[model samples]
Target: MLIVGLTGGIGTGKSTVSKVLRDAGFPVVDADVVAREVVEPGTHTLEKIKLTFGPDIIKNGALDRHKLGDIVFSNNTELARLNAIMQPVINSAMVDKIAFWRAQKVPVLIIDVPLLFERGYENNDYIDKVVVVTTSPQVQLERVKARDNLDETKAQNRINSQMPLADKIARADYLLDNNGDISFLEEQIKNLMTELKGIAPKYGTK
Candidate 1:
């Protein structure tokens, strides 16, 4: 299978791009969703999180993501500690899901991992292409604030935490700009999809 790793900075319409790819018949393996799944009620990840961050991180029998985010964001040591505890589990689960897609002989699999570059896992041999969604900083801030219901400062902080859009573009094999309306973004994705179809088979299509 051709694994396309799609990523974007906070609020760059990465999800929208992923939706476009899915609508175009590509199977998307969402890392964020799988991360949550691995930490659900009975999972070992949840237990480890509870033990590491304590019962306070849980609310009404479910992990309070906001509370945990607050803790990690406040302290770099805490954030690194949390990543250490969670990343391995998330990565393993993602690999397993991708393996299933490969077994099914899917032509294209989009792994929507927001931190693909930041996590330093961008060039995995399994990944055939890296597509980064791009947008201006102003647009990114505006979109993220509106979508996440976050204030300017908070949204900026989140944006600051990720790799810059410029670096992502430099590293990507393909770029989809989402600085405009939905229709424009959709068109860009369509072009990229057509481009991928031509490239994948040459790389020894699975």
Candidate 2:
């Protein structure tokens, strides 16, 4: 299988691109979805999280993500600690899912990892391509602010917390500019899928 690592900063439409890739018949292993899955009620990871952050992070027998997000986003140490608790579980699950796709002879597998470069995940040899979705900083700020109900400074801070969009684009084997209309974005993805399928099969077969 061809493992394509897809990444972008918040509000860059990474999820939107992932969905298009899914529609193109590629198996997508979404990290955010997997992260939420690992912390679902009755999981050991949830127990560990409760132990680490205490009871207030949970509410009504489910992980209160907003409450935890409020805490971690404001504190770098706490954010790192939360990542320590979650990354291993997420990575392991990703590995298993990728292996299953390969065994099933899937031609392409998109790993929708938001923090692919930020968290030092570039060294993974299985990633046949890196596709970075990008948008202008101003547009990103506007989108995130509206979506998250955050002020300008907070939205900028969140954007700054990730690796710069320029750097991601430079590192990417493919680029998807998402600053345009949805139809334009869809057209770009369609072109990319064609290009990727041609090279992806050659590498995976070798």
> Candidate 2 versus the native: TM-score?
0.95
Cα lDDT of candidate 1 equals 0.86
The residue pairs in collision within model 1 are none
Whole-model lDDT values for every prediction: 0.86, 0.89
Per lDDT, the best of the predicted structures is 2
lDDT of 2 at 147: 91
- The residue-by-residue lDDT of candidate 1 on 1-206, one tens digit each, is 67899999989999989887888888999998998998899888899999999999989878999888767765778888889988999888888998898888877789999999988767577787899999999999998889878889877877877778899999999888888899998888888988888776665555
* Shift of residue 52 alpha carbon in model 2, Å: 1.5
Query: Which regions of candidate 2 fall more than 4 Å away from where they truly are?
Result: none
The clash count for each model shown is: 0, 0
- The ten-residue window of minimal lDDT in model 2 covers 197-206
The reply for model 1, stretches above 4 Å from the true place, is none
